[model samples]
Target: MKNIYSILFIALGLFSCQQEEITAEDHLISYDIEEVPVTEDYTVGALYVVNNWSSNIEEVPLAGHYLNGDEEAMKQHILWADSAAIDYFIFRYSYPTVNADNDILSAFLNQNTDSLLNFALRYNFAQMNLTKENTLEGQGKKEDFIQSFKDMIPYFDQPTYQKVDGKYVVNIIAANQFYCDSLELVYHELREEMSALGYDLYLTGEQTGWTPPARFEHYYFNALDAVTFTNMFNNAWYDRHVFLPQSLDQHWQYSKDYYMDKEGIELIPTVAPSINPKISNPNASTYIIERDTNFFWSILNVAKKNIGPSRTIIVNSFNDWNFNTQLEPADSYGSSSLQLLRNQTKKN
Candidate 1:
């Protein structure tokens, strides 16, 4: 009987030892999880492409039909975008509207902080969006917008999750010079207020003619993560070398070199689909996007190679009617582009 009791004690000791071993393994599993490889084949790891600057420009908050169409109705149309595993959604909202609704903004940030800090936020400056002002860029509204962001920075600093560098992203689109002029001073002040916040700002502009000085020169570009281009053109204007297909790599290389050497910063890549103004605006100029999925795939491949990041990529837009680069799951394509994005993102 004494021998039996001794055997029971030994078995209990062995079980306790095994339990300790399992707990230690679980604690170290994340660190032990194979690090994301940076091999040639290990592409498309962390990348993204948004269609355009997004906006919650809804004045009435009518549930179904939003700024463009009905919410429930549009989902049926969001075929391609339904399963798109986009890493970050740079949701854009006008500065003026944010300025007016401190309470709403605070509530929104609180609710979304959980999701957005994990994602990305690219605040836009659409003067016509917030107010009925035809154009604020012409009327010293730049300063007003800058002041608005100064107020916004503290909120950006207090987020649930931030980028890999702990910096929050803010993007501006439009007259590059005007916005930059406002931002240069604003960011400096913002940095002071939120010293611990290593927040960065991104400035995007339409490729204003290929010329000197690059037009958009802001003091903050030096402190920015990247400067992106919004390709508003169709087919990226292929170089018709005697009707032969010009390699996308060759043309982009020169552009990349010039942009990097001259601007002293890397540029983001973008591929667009069809841009039809008739769908949304009759006055806007349209571009011919013959191949949608192939174009998207090519750009994704290029971005994966050049950026070489597991995440953070740019797309022309998800839905911009005037330039018609929407990926919002149309009944026509039936989620083809969106499915491709998900599948490609999942690939080796």
Candidate 2:
């Protein structure tokens, strides 16, 4: 009877040891589970700056002025943008003299804090030195365009490059200049070549002029992935001498209802602090929109309500001082615009 009891105790001890072994393997199994990669949510308020980095002057006569490509000045500018929740800057890239601007972008990217901010290229092909001889219809121009895309592949592949719907986003300024038939060919060839190189492209056309065949039809012939407006209002409005916020609101509603809702095309809306072309061209008229906090707050609310959270909201510029539309810190406004953007973005 004693031997039987002893044998039963030994069996229970062995079972307990086996249970401990199984528990040890459970943690190892858990560790084998792969962690999911963190990705930015597109539904959030992601702000982009249509940055103008072409300033040559080291200082302006105006207070709070700084050079466009000055590394130290840009560092502060980027810090302010980051604080304002700006996700990216679509640097305006014109041909020939873009090397300086490109260097500025490179400097920004080289910063350790650059992960909080990013940049993409806004190719200003119209301003580029392309003549009729080098247009898409002209010989060798199509190949030239393809080569440009190939050259950009390295930049597009960078970790900080902005992507929409899993494809690198490239905004083309002056899209109307490209012939539709030629553009279609160029689009297809670019897509094919890019795909072959294991990359995807999302081309956006910054279509100016209020007149349109509806939003979807805007890019029907051009074969672009999406369409957006560079300037929301017509030049006629600029000549009117009165810029109404109500009119802007009505235009927003029209775009939201007709273009976005009915046509089902992705729309990226632009919000300018003010428009003062006269600052650059003395003879030009000025259509000033007020820059009070309420001004940006109202526009942001309208965008949120109408456009939803899935699309990017573009600020007209970061540093377009000559045109008087910069959001950079100025001695006049201080950080008022930046504060407004940060506040509005947070509230929305």
Candidate 3:
């Protein structure tokens, strides 16, 4: 009887150990047969928002909410981004604002002297409060608007500025909100101005196909070299509270078919690590996509598979705790997101 009881205890211990091993192995990402693609030379950039970092955030960062201009924080960020194999940092900017964004950009430029990683600009026109006169009709306002690009020439000339095929990459946020007679003309003029200064510009607009089948004219699509989103959320799925993988996957397919295949505009897909709008946008419909490393891995695979010839993918953000789409190290998931990113990038 004593021998039998001892044997049963040993068996239970063995089973427990096996279960633990399996659980640990499950955490590591594995590729599916279809997912293991003949990898392309892909470039990935993460949106880096410069904010008053001392403010409150629900998803506490591992390093805490440090100031935007903190040199150490910026240095750490650079190191982490490079380690993660991130190609560049896409920063949010606004015209004529010498605020936190400028301060952080200056800090980044000053610190990242060796050009360890590249950087790009995404001008949020929505923050500019431009009137109709400023966009089209007012005398010299059009030129004034064009001059903004010229002002950015110094930054573009930097060794760290992101470029593709000899043209500097610049993105416009809220371009759809630009109340103008011809949005196409505005972009054309901007390009012509840059050309005159011996600089080729690759402009990307962030205003196409929030809804699956885009209704914008063909000429409208021609305004920029490519189109992308800040965060590609499936509104219908969110509204219905059915956030499945297919809900997101179908959107990528739609963008590929409609924007790239049909319209001939390159679509730079933005993949999210996770999304939680509950904190910053309480009044808005509350939706949360829990922080799952596998979810990020899957979305990244989807993005890579659907990428246009440009071979570019934008991670929604590197540090946006408000909407909770950040890939930066957080208290709950320290460096795991970056690790996963590095894994995917290395595989490709």
Candidate 4:
């Protein structure tokens, strides 16, 4: 998905896990997967709270505890994976304060002990784009967005936990943001630069079939290695307004099948039970609904069936509350959602 900043070419594209151990007290909890324990190659985890989670600063909830809580989350996640024996998680940089080099992300990646979950970060060079429009803390603009991203590359250059083919495997996100035409121009440039730095790039997007099949094919389909479509069904009303209880996977099978046979693009299948925007300020024009656990697992099953070998299955999100497609353990379903994922991965 590409984001049209109105300031640029004006289109937009938009856009983890853990493990561990055996415990009796953990058994008394609601997360069904929490009770059982498994040891397999599967890794299932969630998006951790960002450093901005400290509230009113930038993002919401400010899950600062995740700075340390991730270890616990991993412990709990591993316990739940018992059903599916999940061993890997697509984790990302939610807390940049811990270690910008991804050292914070890698610690959990080691999985030195049993009943543990492994990880990789869905890193974003765009965070540097989070800076002020022209300065460090002013406002944002499309013209400045490019430089913002280029500046953030140093952080990801460091060695982290999980490496693919040797180097750290990072799901470089929002490569298609700003505008598909213009932003991607920046992407190729960044890709070249990052490659020179010896970093591997895994591009994810939703252009595979967002429009008439022709347009999708012409612009987005064959352009990248993986496509993690937005877990959203908004803007369906032809722009102006959006309605929630959004259909994330609506018509999703068509995409899964298309990417599988037609484009042969690696499908990073993302499944979210639902989409919502209630968590944001009242003015937020986005969604605000959580998903149903069963639906999420259904997508997981779909991913397992479609992807193989160089598998890079990307769940809709580990923590995307504002637009509401988070897989992290929350009050509503507790650990039921994660349990379903853990169980399904074991089958895969």
Candidate 5:
């Protein structure tokens, strides 16, 4: 009996050692199993493209390829974004109000009555061929521009629409199109128009390149409340053609030092998980930025550190599958990528 007792004690000791080994491995896991704590230090938004409205998608979303005007998909996405601690989804909208993107946004707005997560609009000014040309025609177009803002007032009025500094937020893509001498005047006119209607607007312009164009002079800073880029891939500040971690670090500092530090304009830092447009554009460039979670963490670290006063960081996209930069879940990474964002955005 005494011998049996001794053997049992030895077995228990071995089991205890095995449990300790398992606990160490669990600690090595990168993300927190607990719920991500909500953050207020900075706000995170994502560019959500509505390309999945059509069929024949080669890439698979964890939520499946949803149909056009699918409110269910939007709900699923809103839940995911909320879980990831994303503050809003900036929809890529075009004019005419008859496209798939508009349909998606309409459906999303219909179901977003609860204001669970906020939404914003991003217009592609280049595609619209809209510019501030400083001519009689340009002056007429400024009225047209004001009308566009008037049209969007309904969207901006939504309780779920994102607001910063008590003004409705709107992002302008291809902002470099405003290369005319009257760029500042054009924006001033728009602001006055909106103000007359009792609607305040906060315009965030997306321009390519790092340094301010000589033509823009001080007018560029005067035109928009904040400046941002779609992504760093197209920005002309990088030394190497290939995108790398070191290049991004330098780019962020250069942008901050020149754009925000020198000029009083705020900078909404943009970051992307990956970049490979070949899937959509068959003739797309071979240039690609491979996906690396550690690298992504480094990016969030750098972006937060250099982010301007607005304290906003916009992810390149939530579901731009064509460019292969979607943050939405997939079999490849599941929720790990978003969890990284949630984990990093926490100030505490």
Candidate 6:
């Protein structure tokens, strides 16, 4: 009897250990990343809005403390943007629901100061899992999208919501993932619903479809008002151990050339200070792009020339801590990027 009990305990211990190992592996499972070398020279240029990935106060580390919707911290962030002449923020609005951390949106909306900044919603479609099996059918998925839009109707009515051509500007990220045979019908229905509710949406589709330019033109561009790249680099670039500056420049040029002559679709180019996702995801396969203010300025300058002043230029992010692409003040690089942005915007 004693031997039998001992054997059962050992078996349970082994099973628990195996479960733990599986969990760890599951967390690290990501798409295989590829890296390519940079070999081209880039021209220098001016800057656009110095936006950061604005997060819940809890995401930011201030004086060794994490803040969550702290009004003072939120105000300080706005002050930083104001000082840097950042026109507005592209706030990440995760779908299916808005989390409590989004209280920062309310803080921004409620502020009565003259230096208040504007914001537009960037729907994080990837996280929403709208493509999950059976999710696209019936009322569940469509209702979710509708409700998400309804929730933002109040924000859309606010004077500070960013607009383009007199319509509220909204960006859908990973829009390709949402594409299906019936996507056009979904969009049309949603647009009709939104029109009924008195909100005109100026939608921009980011990173749409597998085939660049072609799929985007055939599927997404017709539905969206404009299109843009979120990070301006292909997965091959991110797979490498070291990022080549020339590769980034070449990629930007290719993107610019592809969209420059497109007669009907508008292109909004994105600029980034760096690509350093390893800071948050240790398992991240890509390496950081060696960064300086010049790299950022040159990219913006090229984009401004290619897209022209009429189109808006989106900074990759202001506070995306997960991938370490934030332009916010950090312990290692405090306000350097912001100052660079300020200098460039002032030139404009």
Q: Could you give candidate 3's per-residue lDDT for residues 203-288 as a string of tens digits? A: 77776335554645343476777777665652434422343444445666787778766667787878888887655656656457
For residues 19-134, what per-residue lDDT tens digits would candidate 4 score against the true structure?
35545434322122112222334334344434324232223332323553356554554455444344455545532233533544544543325625555566544554442233
Q: TM-scores for all candidates? A: 0.58, 0.73, 0.83, 0.54, 0.79, 0.72
Q: Candidate 5 on 78-175: residue-level lDDT in tens? A: 88988888989998766535578788898888877667789999975454454444542454555666687889988887888898889889998767
- Model 1 scores a TM of 0.58
Clash list (residue pairs), candidate 2 = none
lDDT of 2 by residue, 173-197 (tens): 7675664335677788888998899
**Global CA lDDT of candidate 4, please?**
0.47
Candidate 6 deviant stretches above 4 angstroms? 1-64, 126-128, 132-135, 138-140, 208-211, 215-218, 233-263
Model 1 scores worst on lDDT over the 10 consecutive residues at 42-51
**Candidate 2 structure, TM-score to reference:** 0.73
How close to the true structure is residue 346 of candidate 6, measured as C-alpha lDDT? 52
* Colliding residue pairs in candidate 3: none
C-alpha lDDT score of every prediction, in listed order: 0.44, 0.60, 0.74, 0.47, 0.73, 0.60
Error in Å for residue 77 of model 4: 5.5
lDDT of 6 by residue, 234-275 (tens): 244432223333344444556555655664556676777776
Positional deviation of residue 17's Cα in model 5 after best superposition, in angstroms: 56
C-alpha RMSD for every candidate:
22.6, 22.6, 12.0, 15.8, 14.8, 13.3
Which is the better candidate, 4 or 6, if ranked by lDDT? 6
lDDT (Cα, 0-100) at 97 in candidate 6: 47
